[model samples]
Target: MTGSSHFPVRGIIEGFYGLFYTAPERNDLISFIADHGFNLYIYGPKNDRQHRARWREPYPDFIMKQFAETVAHSMNRGIEFCYSIGSGVSINYASEEDFRLITSKYQAFYDIGVRHFMIMLDDIAAEFHHEEEQLMFNSYAGAHVYTANRLFHWLKSLDKSCKLSLCPTDYHGRAPFSDYIHELGKGLDQEIDIFYTGPEICSETISEQDTADFAAAVQRKPVIWDNYPVNDLAMKSEMHIGPITGRESSLPRVCKGFIVNTMSQAEASKIALLTFAEYFKNPDCYEPWPSWEKALKTIAGEESYESIKLFAENSLYSCLGYPEAALLDLLANKALFSLRSGEAASVSKDVQKLFDYLDSLDEAGYHLKYRMSNYALRNNLVPWIEIMESLAWAGRRAIAVLRALENNEDITAPLNWLKESVSEIRRHPKRYTGSILLPLIEYVESKVD
Candidate 1:
């Protein structure tokens, strides 16, 4: 790693901004981040306009005050807060009230010591806007920018200096981000910051050209909002982050800071924050990262990639269809997650024992340990199990079906799983325990033979 190209981060903000509404136990999550070395936490509110549910209502006065408590707690620990409002009112159509509402609320955040503001444009829409402009407006954070920049200018208008960050609709997080770097950084330089995630690795060796292209596109250093993979929250399968342990070593050397997005799954926020910290603080960060050896030690209790995968896969399975969705959201950070549940891994060889145990379950026709019983397993738990120590690809599909049943959610996925499970048992008699897995056996047995 070249010292010169790598703009050393003086302080780090291993962020886990909430994309959804606040979680019930947010108080615990905030305390965890401060204990770690995170400098910022982006509180981006979700749909709260309805003024409803437990935590779903708009940032209630009490909630915002509590949010302030977390920020103050972070400040005492040296962390900063970034208030990111919605991206809905970006175009010319939004009323002045929307502007007043956002700014006034934002001022509340400012009163709490937030130094940075991120305007997300892609989320807001203008019916009259063209796709290109729509994309561009999204990139610029639409009318929110009008409010934010107006806020920026207002603060500056009042001679107050503040930081401005924008998440465009596209570009910054795309494969072609570099192709439009200059444009992506337009009008938002000096004080403006770019926060983004992408479908491809912009910092990989093989994707050097793309990385370089992306680096050139932002015109200024961008902040990394590294996203963890997620399907549906209800599925047990959407549990783990992929094994990109080495990814931290490859981020664009030019990035100003990175916030490993922990989304709504705030409970495990500390785990994600710690992973990024270890990688960034240590120079040979990736080469040994938690050392594949030690990471493995925790993964399978015996230092091997296979053991680690099982720990992740099965744990994911256990978490499958867990309700409180807030839990599912945080568990998405599969990358740094350790899998084994009760044992302390003292050596690498122990992992084989763990897998062997799982294998024994499979042999005994005990598929619950696999995906058969969980949504995270994608239907046939075998596919997830076989690859637990090998792949996380099946996770791409949402936990559409099983999760619904798990959560007692009314979504179509779970209902269909039940209907299908019954017909499936009849069509394929060899699948489950004759006593338990049989289709509606109670209903079938209650009638005359």
Candidate 2:
């Protein structure tokens, strides 16, 4: 089966740096992607020791069994399971022993009916680490091209149908591409696919021109490793639950395919993946917000859709740059503007509207925290949920402080509560609603002193 999309290849890559998914979670995700029209699943989580740090070592028996099971399930679902190896950290490119180890690792997977493979050289130093490699090759790209070519030929020898791809060290940025990228592109086997992220590691936008420029440099169309919802490294505190944005509809015509890098939170990552599915199926007609809404409704179900929607709205700030807490921000801005005018009627209407929105935020938090039936999603979202609740409560108290002082009543109680809630919210490192609530708190503080 070719899977479901206008784009020939569209799927997920378990390529994040943190804790990888469990076997059941991965299998479930394979099913999820298969159902959503994704045709490929690349297994290459950085934290998978055998796949990365200890690239020369074999997977443990239990782990190998899991791989076999996953490959079988993915095949049954019509999704290609592409096993990947990240050996750039310490592979001796000139060493025949190292080459043997690479083939030996892949041979095991090939034995189990796996046919697609990728040699990921991303996120590693470009300089030759081994003396033998330094002596044999003048540049980083030269060494990489030699090793990757050997592996591609080996995989083809084992089975002519086997496919190979590479994720180079200089995977992002615009042309004038680095000499390393240009040389690697020109020298590598014509059939071996190369992976490219857009202009940045986590690109905000990927235009058709961007891919066209990259393909011109690489001498072949690239397989995009689009990194959006993956919240690893610097973005660990973020919950990237927004829709896929910044990718032009015309991308399918220019590039070979797409492989989305997902977040460690498998359940939460589905929200964005669902939208990605919509894009892949009909890029020309895709609308991020509508697709996102549909995904929320499908994943959260009817009973909890509104609550999940409210919660999701606050956490939409990822690399895609969607507004954080958009509705709450609008209401708060209106309320603050009305307060500045010193109009009692305006303040009463606007501030109350802001307060009501905050109340809804709090209510959404409570519903997801206590009653949402999807336990895995709830668990994945607990950190952001708690932060949202705290921010909502704190915002409410800030408004209360303003009201009590406005009424010429004692402000000590509300003021103290406001301080405590803000403190509690700040204690957690995760972000919710961005800085939209800060001005209200600042305004309240300025008046009291």
Candidate 3:
């Protein structure tokens, strides 16, 4: 199978911690996913109390109605709607009452046309909390296996084709497999899919060998819960705007399928998600740069594509790595080195071009800040934009300082302006990933000092 058939399940999972999307946003996302060759949309926002903290309670009528409408909309677009409940937060594996509650909760979603269900045991305690549960089951994984098997059997009874995905408590780690995972793998029904986040929760890369090893250990092909383009958890400070790389082409063959966990900023996430769609469709032939360029053009549209691309280059630094900003950093280094080596005449044209690029980035920052229609993108990207704008200002000042040195003029004011620009860039709250400007700024500051 290739294209849509190759990856039986390729889509986005609304599995972030903070700020769940509004109903309209989710509906738009469903349409977006369907158009981009994605087939699944898992509704598993961590903050939804009824889905997690209050697992036994029914959603209020308004929320339930929204879910029904969303399900209908997803169906209209040829997408599978997977309703995920985080019942493991407080679920009692040994209690018949808890089992009934779980069934009833899923029944409600099944009534709303959700044929796919996910029970998320991630981020919950690994041990059996209740004394009764400890007595009933030998281990925590044993308890989860019991609940998941019961739920899977019930869902199968309702519809034999219904799919179930389980997110285990021990989802990510290297070596020394936890007893919980071993028991869950040994005990889980073959029909139930298991979710794994590779070797780490927010892994930088997921190799095919790692996935294959995990499959061997787990006795089933794990469904990759890819945490790329997701900016929650420890990555809350950075926005991941780069293309999806580091995943081997053979990943789809080893794992069940890949589902990207998107950022809170839906519009911005499309830049990476579209590339992910291309990768899922044909990882063997996928090229990150071309896919990323296409994604940028698609997200920003022709009118604003160039401008957004300039801004996106600076924001492309993520946990994955910073390939997009590599050329810019190289140019900055060359410009600075040329000035320092008294090769000003030879590097003049290159310096001019670099300055022009910086000016364009400043203008792009202005456009993204004031004129962009996507409020989520604008709001979520404010920190990076601030940094980019400052970098542009600093770059321009560096050029001015170089020109002044070439002309044998006093460079005090321009140097001060450069320092101030660097300071402004440093003032932003989030600066871990996208700091391409840091090296250039530090080099220039060293010269000034």
TM-score of each: 0.56, 0.97, 0.90
**Could you give candidate 1's per-residue lDDT for residues 27-111 as a string of tens digits?**
4545655565555666554334311111212466886777777677767765566666554444332445545655666566677
Off by over 4 Å in 3: 174-176, 322-324, 342-353, 370-380, 398-420, 439-449
Q: Show where candidate 1 strays beyond 4 Å.
A: 1-24, 45-58, 89-95, 123-148, 157-161, 171-184, 199-211, 229-236, 241-243, 246-252, 269-272, 287-310, 313-356, 359-449
Candidate 2 lDDT over 1-449, as tens digits, reads: 12234578787899999999999999999999888888899999999899999999999988889889989999999989999999888888899998999899999999887999999999998777678787999888888888999899899888999999999999999979899889998999999999989999999999999899999899999989999899999999999999999999889777888999999999999999999988887888889999999999888888999999999988888899878778888998988888877844225798898889889989998999899998899999999999898888888898888878777889899899999989988798898888898898888888889
Clashes of each: 28, 0, 0
What lDDT tens digits, residue by residue, belong to model 3 across residues 209-257? 8888778767999989999999987777777888998899888778878
Query: Comparing candidate 1 with candidate 3, which one achieves the higher TM-score?
Result: 3
Pick by lDDT: 2 or 3, better one = 2
Deviation (Å) of 430 in candidate 1: 23
Ten-residue stretch with the least lDDT total in model 3: 431-440
RMSD of each: 13.5, 1.8, 2.8
